[model samples]
Target: MKVISDLEIAQTLHLPNECEELQLLMMKYECAMTEMITKLEVLSSEMSLKFQRNPFESIRCRLKSPQSIYDKLCSHGYEVSYQSIRDNLNDIAGVRVVCSFIDDIYLLASTLKMQDDLLVIQEKDYIIQPKNNGYRSLHLIVMVPIFLMKEKEYMKVEVQFRTIAMDFWASLDHQLKYKRADIADADAISEEMKISAELVSQLDNHMLQIRERIDAGEK
Candidate 1:
């Protein structure tokens, strides 16, 4: 039995009879995501072999849903077409890399950026300068060439590097903000999450320092 994907279900609901082309487009996005994930996995594996440890703890990837793509285009006052998706949306494919230490995030990011095939189009170092709400993560917009059966196409993917503590705090904070969006104490919740984000960053930095000290034979 062929597995029906969520994107297929979404395309059926939104695009109707006009989805034949979009299906192929979605496949390309999926393939691009797969290629990025493989690159990340290989990097992690090579790091483990060389350093006796993996730089990242986990890897996750996702393709944008058809509905999400449509909505985002509409919300941005852009035409909802394949051309628009190619031109405007840089995050059709996303990859999140979670690391054990804050330094690991930077280390992996620098290594990934140095790859010949991957182009770091944009970089956001949120670890050094977090958001007002305390969200901290390194975001990179990377472009890579995806070779198809007939031709090769350059695709953009959004890659995020986060330490385990940063991921933990961000996941919980996102859940609370999403689930409790209309709660009466929303301001208070936002303030509390901001504080929590600061504490998480501090802890991440502290752990990195401890690891550095250990590496330096300081015990």
Candidate 2:
């Protein structure tokens, strides 16, 4: 018989009383995210060599913290049950892929979707149609199989594909969102950021056209 850890029991019981349990479960989620990241790394490396061009600039992974999970559940008006956490939260594990060019973002996303083992649960193309706040990225919710010693577990992860300029814009915008501010000043800042996003979008398109012309001349 296998002895289950406190965290394993907590997962089954759906009680958030024990801090250690939440910590252990989050660690396991982190491990799952790590496995997915490694898979993406291999795919990116092989594709770069085959195409003679690197499609991705960088890959990053993160596991949401226990506090964040709890807050999210509360925000959605759900009870803080372990099952609710699993069922309601689709982004417990997240991966961010930054690309050198705008075209590279779509290319990488299509390649990932073609993988047999990964299942695309949902997709939001914020690139083609930017959000009201001027946010843009290709977001994919995918389920990946992770094999363990005893059995295999399928985990849901949010994968975001974006150009370097898009990533930079998002990073700055995230900082602005977290800061406390007056209403009038915040509206002005948001409008300025929207203008910045438009400029960045134009730059991405211009760079893509230049790269395409260069490739065309070589061929």
Candidate 3:
């Protein structure tokens, strides 16, 4: 894999002389993360062109390590370790594809999976099975290769597929849930969110139907 230059790693860590060793170690992780994100972006663009769909609205990738790794190293005990960060990254390597209609999400996801370069490690069809919190989207863990001057290494990245309507509702839910402590009962809020989600789903289906009908007439 591409070995990151020591200077670049140093600049990113910004650690003092006392923490020079840790800085070097952190650089390897950072380089791996940077490479993963770059590959994801390229894949996203290619998928967009192949499927005649808009590119991802937003794409991000991250790396993490467990707290035990740090503890075993006998280094300073950081509240957040690389492993924890990596876990969170896996949870959110979110690639939101905001389309004009909801069916576009499924189309885009299916098209992406067909690419040979991308290896699907796991998939959670949240669109088909949304979370109890009304979270809706397709979560896929994909492994992509990053070619360096010396070698090539594969990195895992999480990709989340969602539509504009779903994004809007999720954003609002997050803001409202965090803004107030004792706002409403969790179940009550969840039920309301579910109702909204169903409405959005119906709207997506209706729009797709309209498009199909128009295409039929043109033909």
lDDT of 1 by residue, 1-219 (tens): 123354564453354544666667667777777888889898888989987788988998888766678778888998877677788998988999999998778778888889998898999999899988899999999987799989988788899999999999989987788877988998998998999898898898899898888878843
Best by TM-score: 1
TM-score of each: 0.90, 0.87, 0.65
Rank the models by TM-score, top first.
Answer: 1, 2, 3
Please name the candidate that would achieve the greatest lDDT relative to the true structure: 1
RMSD of each: 2.7, 4.2, 6.5
Candidate 1: which stretches are off by over 4 Å? 1-18
C-alpha lDDT of candidate 2 relative to the true structure: 0.81
The digit string of per-residue lDDT tens for model 3 on 52-105 reads 555456644443332333343344343333344334334322334456666666
Report the C-alpha lDDT of model 2 over 51-72, residue by residue, as the tens digit: 7887888998877755577678
RMSD of 2: 4.2
Better of 2 and 3 by lDDT: 2
* TM-score, prediction 2: 0.87
